[model samples]
Target: MQRLLPQHVRAATFDRRRWRGLDPEQVYAYLDRLADELERLTRDLCTANTEGERIRQALRQWQSRHTDCRHTQVAPNSRWHR
Candidate 1:
């Protein structure tokens, strides 16, 4: 599902009732804070995703380079085999 962007939150409009309606100032202030948090979270998520892809690529390259050794057996006398 698509997520809401900071602009969406800032541009949101709510219907006001004749009586007992929500305070527009409070709603706008809260929306502003929510938008700010969403923007920060979006940035953080992007950074994390990019870093994760980098790590995945590095892991794939390392695995390809080590593919031959993956099937090799070590002697019983080898410290690593022990």
Candidate 2:
């Protein structure tokens, strides 16, 4: 799975060389927008992670319930059993 950077950090650090010429007010506004975007992204990521975990747990449970181990045992007339 691909990992995503938090939006605020990505925005702040985006094109750092070009950002050097930006005025203070613009910088502050960018940071504010970044912060909001980051918060929303974080919440979404958490929800997705939780849902993934739940799906994984459910798959595990279903697999365990349906798996058959009887085929692994020796047959009644098998020489190895004697």
Candidate 3:
């Protein structure tokens, strides 16, 4: 429901319960907090996905280039070799 529920719907919906059930206000508060976190995490995930795609594209472009292969592929005994 997190993905399907709109922010307005989340804000407006209320749970039905018996006399001994949990407090409606508490449930609403908790749901509101959860909804806020869900929104934040969704945005973060999209940003991370976008950045990952950009990095992948850059790596592909770099791999396609053929100039200066020696510097990029140094020998095992080179200064930058591990």
Candidate 4:
């Protein structure tokens, strides 16, 4: 679940002078890549949450269906006396 920079973005030391020298196009590309990654991560998290909810609901239903009921016993001598 670690976040990483998109493949297109190179990992390099950001010297102020070098950063300032980069072209506008490169900056725009980096921003676009980051946006795409963020969107994908958001979608993945939402799907995971939904699946977890479904599993929890299923488990609850199964537990309810399989629950044990209390039973009472009657003595044969008591019935015969009655």
Best by TM-score: 1
Q: Compared to the true structure, candidate 3 yields what TM-score?
A: 0.65
Q: Which tens-of-lDDT digit does each residue in 18-68 have in candidate 3?
A: 767778888888878877887887789889999999999999889778456
lDDT of 4 by residue, 1-82 (tens): 7565444344433444654576656766776777688678878988999999999999988878767522434566786445
- Candidate order, lDDT descending: 1, 3, 2, 4
Residue 15 in model 4: lDDT: 40
| Candidate 2 lDDT over residue span 1-82, tens digit each | 6555565354554343664565756777777777778789889989999999999999999889867754578888999786
- Please say which candidate is ahead in TM-score: 1 or 4: 1
C-alpha-based local distance difference test score of model 1: 0.95
Q: Candidate 1's residue-wise lDDT over 1-82, tens digit each?
A: 8789999999999988789889988999999999999999999999999999999999999999999997999999999985
Worst 10 residues of 2 by lDDT: 7-16
Report clash pairs, candidate 2. none
How accurate locally is residue 75 in candidate 4, as Cα lDDT from 0 to 100? 69
The worst-scoring run of ten residues by lDDT in candidate 4 lies at 6-15
User: Which scores greater on lDDT, model 2 or model 4?
Assistant: 2
Error of 3 at 58 (Å): 0.4
lDDT of each: 0.95, 0.74, 0.77, 0.68
Q: How high is the lDDT of residue 61 in model 1?
A: 97
Q: Model 2: residues >4 Å from true position, as ranges?
A: 1-21, 69-82
TM-score of 4: 0.56
